[model samples]
Target: MGSLVVFSPLFFFVLAIQMSSLMVSLSQEGFCSAPPILNAADSTAQPLYWKVTNPTLSPSHLQDLPGFTRSVYKRDHALITPESHVFSPLPDWTNTLGAFLITPAMGSHFVMYLAKMQENSKSGLPLRDVERFVFVLHGTVFLTDVSGVTHSLNVDSFAYIPPNSTHHIKCDASSTLVVFERRYSYLESHYTDLIIGSTDKQPLLETPGEVFELRKLLPTSLPYDFNIHIMDFKPGEFLNVKEVHYNQHGLLLLEGQGIYRLGDSWYPVQAGDSIWMAPFVPQWYAALGTSRSRYLLYKDVNRNPL
Candidate 1:
């Protein structure tokens, strides 16, 4: 005689429920041989997750390996990438980080940097001897001048602090600023004053061929040894000619992508990229892609060759 074992319907139901739950857990953990189908229109569907193939790198870093940069340095020019820089605190500054883009070490007489300031941060004191130009990239800032006047600045706003003037900065909100500093070039009976304005309010000067437009941030007067300009180019626009002169330039691409001709080499540049064109280096630019390209250009102007 043989003995027969029997299971109840309730036991089979419980086993099926347990198997379904295990499959769901495995699928959510990316261990399932087949993933559950997701309804495209179902707004309440549970979000799916997948295990990273490489546990060492994050999602963002998985595509870009460490220690790789598009920057290049040459005898006459240098192309600097945002990844090539390390931010550090500067003297007389608190709660701020600065990445110096161009400096005397790069054969630039002027120092240019991109500064990030946290809310409530302030510049320690008024800088001495050096004239400074500050451009607001985003958020709000207040500039207190020698006369105890505090000027509120917003995006696209800029301030020119004259040499030997008392000027301090306080960030009203988290802000990004482009700062340029250099010694004032002394001239007889000529003086520079603290000027404040916004680039959006400036009139755009279209080129003769209408290829591009520019807005002069600083006055063209001789008392100012340096000049800053914002150049805007529509897609497919380009400079009319290759420019080669005694003037040196420190340029920061503000928006869009473009191809820059520096010396004899051509480099692809985009927002956050910086270029330093030394004296007599041939240079030109052409806008690429679908959007407009814009850049902040700084040049040593109104000064005689020494």
Candidate 2:
């Protein structure tokens, strides 16, 4: 009986080990609890960003991670690398949407995408109530309206679509395009005609020697609540002043390197960088490298007081 008691504990330990191994195997074979369903428990299945905790951990009031100099947005965050890009394939089209600003997480009003579409891929502009702007970054984007008018936009080309317009976009060659959309709001006497232009073809206007002078893309006559500019800065030149404005700006750094003074902080930005600066957040920038610095700029303007 004494020998049996000693062996009994060993036998039970072996049995427990076997049971653990079986449970792990069963879990691996999909026999355990069901995994979280995509688009079931939350609006987004994958975690988009890492939360910040300064000195405390709280769900209701998380902080932006340190590394910013001084920021107006307590919720400010940035994706400093290309791998930080968030892309999901559109279900309707095989093309990919590299969305940077999505929904309420984005400030105020715009849905932006760095879209990749191959030749013969088609996409429709926002139909009834949305307006769209497409800037061709590489290759060819062919825009055709319902009236049969077609516009072929190449590298550095831009187009504006009005609200309620029946228009479609086709990529004749595999291309990368930046698509920006906003809800259409019009004022009486709003000049609503479509405009097409190219940064390569248009003469650089209103710029003084190597200074950052931005030439406007859309004619001021158009009643757009927003404006776009192809801005330039010579090497070692900066905005030259600390300024704050009521306008929010979206800047896509197209060429060269620079220092951006945003929301009371300084950041070194380079080509292919996209920046979103909220309205009234103090900002400025200076070109750093030997090459001329350039960026495609978007500014919200002419809106009634909130």
Steric clash pairs (candidate 1)? none
Per-residue lDDT of candidate 1, residues 1-306 (tens digit): 899989775465446445544544564454423343333344124221111111111224324345656789998899987767668996789888888988889888888887889978887553566899998876789999999999999877899998888778998678888889988889999999899998888898767765788899889998999989999989879899789999989998876666788876767676778899999998988887556688889988888898
In angstroms, how far off is 50's CA in candidate 1? 30
Rate residue 277 of model 1 by lDDT: 90
Clashes of 1: 0
Query: In candidate 2, residue 18 scores what lDDT?
Result: 56
lDDT for each of the candidates? 0.77, 0.62
Q: What is the lDDT of candidate 2?
A: 0.62
Candidates' TM-scores? Answer: 0.78, 0.70
Error of 1 at 187 (Å): 0.3
Top-lDDT candidate index: 1
